[model samples]
Structures are given as C-alpha cells and as structure tokens.
Target: MTSKNNPKAFPLNLPEGDAELLLDELQTRLREGRRLFAEVGQILAEIESRGVRDLYGYNSIAAFYEHVARVPRAEAQRVTGRALALNSRRARDGTTIDPVAPLTGESASTGALAEAGIDRIVTVMKRLPDHLDADERLEAEKGLVELAGVARPRDVTMAGTDLLARHDPDGKPKDDPEPKRQRSEFWLRQKRTGRWDMRGNLDPETGARLNALLVPRAYPAPGEVADDRAPAERRGDAFAEIVDLAEAGPDIPAPRQTAERVTEEPQPAQPSEEPASRPKPTQMPPQGRQSPYRGSGEGVQESAATERSRNVAHLRPPRWWARLSRPRSGNAAQPHKPLTA
Candidate 1:
C-alpha cells in the first residue's frame, strides 16, 4: 500500500503502478495545457490585429472569447496581455528573432514551468519600467526563468521582486503624489441616536503631527499623580482637549458668504387703464387723561403698587414703569379715571 502523500494515492481506485502511471500522464497533460495556453494567446493577438471581431460581429476580442470560448473577460485580457508580452519576436531588420518571455512562455512550452509560475514571472516583468532597455529586460527574464525551474510560484514572485528592487531601488514607473492623497480619507457619520462615528486614514505627516500633539496630553496630569484612568479614557480626554485647543486657535475660519440671490430686473409695471389706489389708514383719537394707577389699554384699574405686588414686587421697578407712576406734567392733581376700551 502506498502512503497518502505518494503519487499512486491520487488515482484511489487503481493499483500503485497504475496510479503512478496516471499521475505521470496528468503531469504531462498539465505541461501540454500550459504550452497550449501560450499558443492561444498568440492566436488571440492575431485575431485582434486582423480585426476579426468585425467579421464575427463582436465588439471586442474579449467579448468574443467570453461568448465563444467561455473565457471570462478578465482572464481573456490576461491571456491577450501575456500573448503580446511573450510571443513577439522581431529584430531591427524586420526578421523574426527568438520569442520573448524566456521565463514564462519558453519554459512553459518545455514543460519546465506551470501556469502559476508563468503568471508570477509575467506579472513581475509587467511591473518593470517601460523605459528599460532590451538588454536589461533580457537579463531579468533570464534570471527569472532559471529561478522558476526549481522554485515554487511564490518563491519565483519573491525572487522577481528582489531582482526588480535591486535593479530599480527607488521603485519603478514613479508614482505621483496624487494617488496617495486620493487614498487618504477621514469620515464622520451620525448614528440614529445622534452620536457620531469618526474614522480616518490619514497621511503619514498628518498622522504624526496629531500623534505628537495628543500623546503628551494623553498622560495623567502632573497634579493627578495617582490617576487610574485606562489608556482609552486618557486618550479620549486628550482628544477632547485637542478639540478645545483647536476651537480656541486663531485659525478658525470666518463663516462662508452665502450665494447672493440673482435678482432679475423688475419688469416695468405695465401702465394700467385704472391706476391702483392706496387705502388710507384710519386716524386714532387723542387719548383723554390717563390715570397713573391704570394701564393704557382697557382693563380693570389696579394701583401701580398693587400691580407690582402681583408680579415681582421685590425687584426694582423698570424706568418706564417708574416714570408712569410719577405724576405726568399738567396732571399732577388730576383725579384717577376708570379705563375703557
């Protein structure tokens, strides 16, 4: 009986020798599949170049492959990409030279590399700078091919990465600062209960600045020598202090100016056959003498003292109320009159 790890164990229903034979056959088939995959890429590229899609009434080669060959859109793109990168063979004299992709395509045809290994190597090559001279690319490809012969796909990927880093220590195809800015964000969302959830991924510089400002405040105050606050509690307090300090800062912005309403020119009032008439306000009669103890409006008469007692008698009288209580000019000795509506 063969151990579970043995190749013979794969074809469980077969004897050891037969199972071993089947395993060998499967390995052979896998190699052939990879080689055929590479060839398919070449065919796909030719189809694209010839505008075969127009003849087939398909929008794109990928779409065609999606329907006809059942290949996914993404996988089709990958296959075509590999084809262009690996199958091209041309010299300055227009004569065909050896195909490129020494690591992936060449090795795949020879049954020395699997699809995963090929993919890894291809991915590494793709990430390399387009400005790389032919010689540099060839050397890199050669190194990866040699490594792939004995290493797993993951190891090949790592090896390729190391090679790339060594070749371009600063990292290739130099990135713009814009994408980093785009990746950074801060979010604050209000929950149904009126509380907020604050979350953010900040740039290194901003994060460092915030950390520097808050870290000191997060520690117990000098006066509270035996503080027992948890780290989170301390941090929360520190954050509150930071917010207060920010509020106190002079950099607080003035409120934004509202957009001015766009006023259209008023249309000239069309001359009317009859001019609009204005209504005159009714003239009010001069009040007869008002009693000092009674309010101006219609109501039961109450002495100023009595009114005050009903309200805030202990409070000093308002200036206007005091003036009203004092005898008016020319009415010093007038008898009090009952109020009327």
Candidate 2:
C-alpha cells in the first residue's frame, strides 16, 4: 500500500522503492524514537523516586546520569529535571503526587508530543498564578497539551504565554500587596589598582529606569569603524556619562570653601613703628659683565644693550656725546660727529 507524503524526510539510506513507503518508514521510526525518549523519562523518574544516592552512591541523580550517560553535568541536570517534572513522584509520607503537567505527561508517554512541546507545557504550568483553582489549572494544562499535539514547540510556547497572561494580568498575584521592605541594593568598592567594582540588585521599576537611561548612550558612535566593545563595557561607559551629567547639572550646588580660608581675613595694615624702608633702586650691571643672552646670539645681546643705552640716552646725554659736542677750547663749533661704540 502507498503511504502519504511527509514534508519531513529522514536523512538515511533507503532501498530503491516507492517514495511513499520510505516516508512511512521514516514516520514510524520517528514516532518510535519519541516513544523511547518518553520511556527514558519514566525510567529516570523511577530512579529518582528510589533515590539515586542510595542506589548508586552518587550525590545527585544528575551526577549519576552524567557519569553513566557520558554527558555534561548541565545537560544531565536538564534531562533529569525535565523527566522529573513529567512524571509522578512519591511524598515522604508515601502519598503519590501528581505530575506538574498531568495532561502533558500523558501525551508525552503516548508519543503524541515531542520533548520540546512537553517542556513548554511544563513551563506554562509552573508559571500559572497561585490564585488559579486546581480545576482551572488542570483545564489550562489540558488546553496546552491539545495545542502541543498539533503545533510546533514555539507555537506551543506562544499559546501557553497567552493563557498565562489571561490569568496573571499584572504578572503577579492579584491579592498580593506591594512589599514594604526595600527591594533594591547597590555596592561599590575600589581596588588598590584604582579600578572600581560595582554590583547591585534592582527592583523592576528601578531596573527599567536604569535601562532607559543607558540604552541611548550605549549605542555605538556613528562612524565607519565598527564598535567592538562588549555590551557590558558599553553599559559601563554609559553609567560614567550619567555620573558626569549629574555632577555638571545646574541644580547641583557648588562646594563650600574651607573654614581655614574663610576665617583668614586680610590683616589690616599696622602703623609701622619705624620709618618705612626706602624702595631699593635698580643698579646697572657692572662694566665688562657678560649679558645672560651673550651665548644665545650676538643679535640678542646687541639688541638688549642698545635698548639699555637708548633708555640711558633719554635720561641724559652720554659722556662721549657731550665731550664731542663741546667745542675745543679755542676752535669754533665743528659739525657734530656720530658717537661710535
């Protein structure tokens, strides 16, 4: 008999024959695989109920699984955790507890839902508001299971989220009041190296405000070069900019002057007991004393000397000039000759 076509074809070598038969074989094998996975969850559940530590001497079921399954600790924990959520458990008093998502567990056991779909349902059930009555919770779980059977994992997630939104509109219990205790905390410490270590926990409102302030500043500068900073680094720089803005804001008051400075008023000038000392007059450099600029350049020295001489000439004519200008005792006045250095 010819089998229906499957959009999802298995990657495997098949005998040359009807494509429909191959597709049917693929589908059958896939369903069997899912059934085997469900059986594994059941087995893990039994192992956990019996206590893996008591049976295998391992500290935890996840550790035991990691050793025997040859998987990473994280992966082992995830698998065992998922399995535990999907299977019924026994209380310390010997009472049997229902699986978190009863309908999902049943569907999974029957191979009607894949692992992904099962996880989605379990997550939704866990997040349901405590206000939901037992019957209402079961009904919600049932709806999700039905959806999981027909839809992809992502679609299942979306449906479950919508269902939760309807029940927990405010994202918390309707009957709970706002907490009185402060929920936010911050810590800052500077190391000997001058680098700062900052960490904190912020309540939802504070976190939202902080996010709004940093997001705009965290964007990479507009330029040809790509910003290679890690997201955390960019956020750090944004925080520093915020601090600077706060410090420079007009509303911030200027720092007060120190008391020492304010108290030290200029002392009033006291009447001098003795006559005020006469101001010392500047004396000319001694003759033949080299100018400080002599080694720098002749032009510098000459310019400085010429400037000094001009000042001197302005005050009174030089001796050489006066002697030259004075007529010889018996000679008539001769044309004044230019003075030479």
Candidate 3:
C-alpha cells in the first residue's frame, strides 16, 4: 500500500532515449568548437610567420601583424602591443611564446591581438626614432602582422613605407627632386608611393635669409591691411611700406648710416649763376645735405688704390722664395735696396 501511494509519482529523470540524444548533441557541439578553434590558431600562426617577414623585410613583429595576419593597419597596431608583451615575457624567462596562437582565439585567452599590436608598435618606436611618432610607430608594428593574417603585410607596409619616407620634420617632405637646371622649379615623384616632391636651388644661407623676410610678408605684421591693387602696384606699395617700417617701426631700432672720412685736395672755387626762374631749396634729403656714403669725393682714387692693395694681399710666394713675388712700391717705407750679388 505504501509503494502504491508513492508510485503515483514517476522518477524525476529524463526518458533514456531523450537523455542519450541530448548527450550526443552536446558532445558534437564541443568537438566542432574545438576543431574550429584549433583551425583558427594554425591559420593565424601561418599568417604571422610570413607577415612578420613581409612588413619588417626579413623579420619583424610588425610585419607579422600586417602581412601574414591580415589585420588592418590600425587594428594591427593595437594587437602588436600584446604580442610584444608576451614575447618580452618569453624572452625574460627563457620561454618561447607564439604571438598568433592567442590572437586567433586558439589559446585559453583571446583579444591579445590588440595588446600584441600595441606592444609591437612600442618596439618599433624604439627602432625608428628618426621617422615615426610614438603612436604611429607602434601602429606600424602592431598592425602589420595581424593584417597579414587576412591579407598580405607586404602590400600594407610597401604603401606605408613609401608614403612615410617622404616626410620631413615640418611634416613636409625633404625634397630630393631632379635638378631643374632649365626652370627654377622641379618636382620629384616617388615610384613606390606615387608621391610628388619639390626642390629649389637656393644657397643655404640665402634661403634662410630670404625665408626670414618672406615669412613676415606671407604672414604680415599686425595692423597691415590688404589692398585690391594690381600685382605690380601691390608690390611697389609693399616695398614702400617696408621702407617706412624700416624707418620707424616700433619693434626694431633704426640703423644709422656710417660716414666715411674724406682725404681732400683743395679745389679752386668755380661759381655758377642762378637762372631767372630757379628757386633756392629750404631743405634736402640726408644724402643731399651732408652725405655720409660719398665722403668728400676727394680721395676716391686713393680708396681705389687701397682696394687694389687688398686684392694683391691674397697672393704670396713661400717665404723661402721671398724675392720671387715681391712687388716694388715706390714709397720711402718700401725703399728699393740694391739686388744682392
């Protein structure tokens, strides 16, 4: 009776057929998932090996990200950093770790690709201090290998390297274009990147001085106004404005003209008659009133002679051959001694 009263309820378990079916399905799913994961791991590793060589040219973690891995340049950078950290750990302890294994969802952990990309970028930064910024260098290393997993890192780096090589410190490219001997301007195009470059042939000092003057004109001083004058008129006005600025600019002190003292010969006075319509001038410009540049125009010949002296000063024979180069100047200081027998 007690068994009959208990028997109204069945055992709280699945029917055997359904239980077996559920177990089979779970086992199948698990096996498939493992297979998929392992497959991904192997593929990523294959990509990384070749990719590293491609972008890095021979061997590099950055290439691994970009080439064999097929990670986009940006994402590859983020992943490369993680790979670097792992490699560093492997390096510190005598352990060898594979970068792609974790990145491809093969290992117990995933998403390390981002970290790997970033770490690789940091390592690359150390290598290319001259060219790349911190973030950009890291990006190059990090993304190269990962990008290779999907596509070819060679393509990515080829494009990137070619483009990057053209930049200078000012973010403009340092131009090494073919000389424009005929024309003043010339352009150079990089075959790999298809970038164009420009060059000019100004001497270094001249270029710097010209830049100093032109930079201000390009970015004019405050209180300057633009005029709708023709190009020639504008240029003339600009010259005049600059002259005025030199004469009385608040920022710069005006330079005084240097005077040359004159050695003069007294000349007999020659008088000229003033014509009927002529008027006397009240004032004259600095040059007309008391000239500093010309002096008295008296010792002009002497000045010319002094310049000649300076010119010949550069020529001299060795002291042992003294008599060979000496020139006779008929002055008491340079008195002629008799030629030695």
Instruction: Assess every candidate by TM-score.
Output: 0.45, 0.47, 0.23
The CA lDDT at 334 in model 2 is 62
Sort the candidates on TM-score, descending order: 2, 1, 3
Residues 1-341, model 2: lDDT tens digits: 88887566446756566799888987788778888888888898888788787788998888988999999998898888888898997765777877887777777877788778888888889989888899999898888888888889999999988997899878863577887887788887656564567789999999999999999877775556667777777777677656545533445543344554366565556478978443322344322222121134544644555454434332332233333456766666665443321
Model 3 local distance difference test score: 0.42
Q: lDDT tens digits, residues 1-341, model 3? A: 34545434334444556877778766666556655544443444444544544545636454555665687877655445444433312333455564422223322133222323333333333334364565654455545545533444345445445444543324444679997655334343433343223356666676787566644443322334543445444434343334433433334432222231123333454457745332222221222111122224424743554344333322331121233235555653664443321
Candidate 2, position 44, lDDT: 86
Q: Identify the candidate with maximal TM-score.
A: 2
Clashing pairs in 1: none
- State residue 332's C-alpha deviation in candidate 2, in Å: 99
Model 3: worst 10 consecutive residues (lDDT sum) = 284-293
List the RMSD of every prediction in angstroms: 21.0, 25.5, 24.5
Tens-place lDDT per residue, model 1, 111-161, is 677667777888888777777888998889888888887888889989988
The best-first sequence of candidates by lDDT reads 2, 1, 3
